[model samples]
Target chain A: MTVKELAEKMNLKIFCGETNLDRTIEGCYVSDLLSDVMGNAKSGMAWITLQTHQNVAAIASLKDLSCIILVKGFEPEEDTLQHAVEEEIPVLGTSQQTFETAGQVYQLIC
Target chain B: MVFEYPVQGGDFTNAGTVSSKVKKMMRQLGVDAGVIKRTIVALYEAEVNIVAHAYKGVITVQLDSDKIYIKLDDEGPGIPDINQAMQRGYSTASPEVREMGFGAGMGLPNIKANSDVLEVHSVVGKGTTVEITNNF
Candidate 1:
């Protein structure tokens, strides 16, 4: 499913990078640790995390992640949103926690 | 080609800038996708190390047809036990750094796992230098 489709299905808030919401999601990686995401996330996965910093956007870009889902109603920081906008990588949000979001996403994609 | 980028200590905002640039260059050069991914992962971890641990550092990248070589030289409190630091879950990062989702002790291991060759040289009081090479 594409990022837009997932957002719609999950009722996720699109914080930035609306232009690239059409990017395809190949898988999902749920991690709050930056190094874990950097080391293990696949190129096209949707990353679920509580990290709201600008480096979150940087890691998403470096790993070529399709989108970032901030869990538990968490939101991206201002600079994080700005970086996501500049990189055209969607920074998404949801009111659900990581486990619920991951389960739903897994059901949708898998 | 050769390129150099400077990294400042405690500069979380710009941590992955160099790796992003190098990834772009590799993609433009038509490097294999897998190779590019591994190189970027390794390079990014090394880059973050400088920002997390060192006062200042410089990354020198040499890109060739067969491989990409990256050397990070930093001025900071060097590692006294490279072996211990290489182990998983052996981070010495400050609480502030950990709060930012870094310093989980996975940085060097991640770098080693992604790179073909990983070399670390350091002196306790002075600094450290990390060398990473990945074959294309």
Candidate 2:
């Protein structure tokens, strides 16, 4: 499914990078650790994390992930949103915590 | 081609800038996707190590047809036991750094997993140098 589809299905908020919401989601990786995401996340996966920093956006771009889904109603920091805008990698949000969000995302995409 | 970028210790904001640039370069050069991914992962880990541990550092990237060689030389309190540092879950990062989702002791292991060759040299009071090479 594409990012747009997943957002619609899961009621995720698109904080930035709306232009690239059409990007396809190949899978999902749920991790709060930066190194874990960096080491294990695959390209085209939707990254679910509590990390709201600009470094999260940087890792999403470097790893070529489809989008970042902030869990538990967390919003991206200002600079994080700015970087997401610049890189065109969607920074998404949801009110649900990591576990619920990850389960739902897996069901939708898998 | 060779490219060098400077890294400031504790500069978390700009940690992955160099790796981003190098990823773009590799993409433009039509490097294999898998090769590019591995190189970026390894390079990024090394780059963040400098920002997290060293006082300052320089990252040198040498791209060739067959392989990419990256060397990170830093000035700081160097690792006293390279072997111990290489083990998973061994980190000396400050609490502040850990709060940012790093220092889980996976940096060097991640680097080793992504790169074909990894070399580490350090002196306790002096500094550390990490060399990573990945064949394309």
Candidate 3:
């Protein structure tokens, strides 16, 4: 499923990178630790994290992650949005907590 | 090709800039996707280590046909125990750095896991230098 489809299915808000909503989703990873995601998260995965920093977007872009899902009603910082838009990776948001949101994304993609 | 990038400690705003630039260079050089991914992970970890711990540092990357070599030399309060630092959960990062979701003590381990060869050198009250090699 594309990120756009998954977002609709899970009710994720599109914060930025609207141009990249069509990117295909290969898997999902839930983690707030940047190094954990950097070391382990695979390309094309939708990274679910509470981190709203600019480095999160840099890591997502460097790892070629399909998109980022900011959990628990967290919002991206201004720099975060800038990097996401620059990298063409979607920064998605949801009021759902990490576990629930990850579970839902896993169900849809896996 | 050899490239150098300077890293400033406590500069979270610019973390990963070097890694991104190196990733782009590898892409343009037509390095394999798998190699590029591993290299980015290792390189970014090293870059962040410098930013989170060092006063000043320089990352020198050497790209050759067989492998890519990266050396990060930093001036800081060097790791007293390299073995302990290599452990997954050990970290000496300040609280401020931890709040940024870094200093989880995974940086060195990540570099080890992703790179084919890794070596670290440090002296207390002096600095640390990490050498990583990822084969293409």
TM-score of each: 0.98, 0.98, 0.97
Q: Name the best candidate (by lDDT).
A: 1
Q: Give the DockQ (2 decimals) of all models.
A: 0.95, 0.93, 0.91
Q: What is the C-alpha lDDT profile of model 2 across A1-110, one tens digit per residue? A: 99999999999998988889899999999888899999999999999999899899999999999999999889999999988898889999999988999999988988
- The regions of model 1 sitting more than 4 angstroms off are none
Question: For model 1, what TM-score is found for chain B?
Answer: 0.99
Cα displacement (Å) at residue A31, model 3: 0.4
For candidate 1, lDDT tens digit of each residue in B1-136?
9999999999998999999999999999999999999999999999999999999999999999999999999999999999999999999999999999999999999999999999999999899999999998
**Winner by DockQ:** 1
- The list of candidate 3 runs beyond 4 A from truth reads none
The DockQ-based CAPRI class assigned to model 3 is high
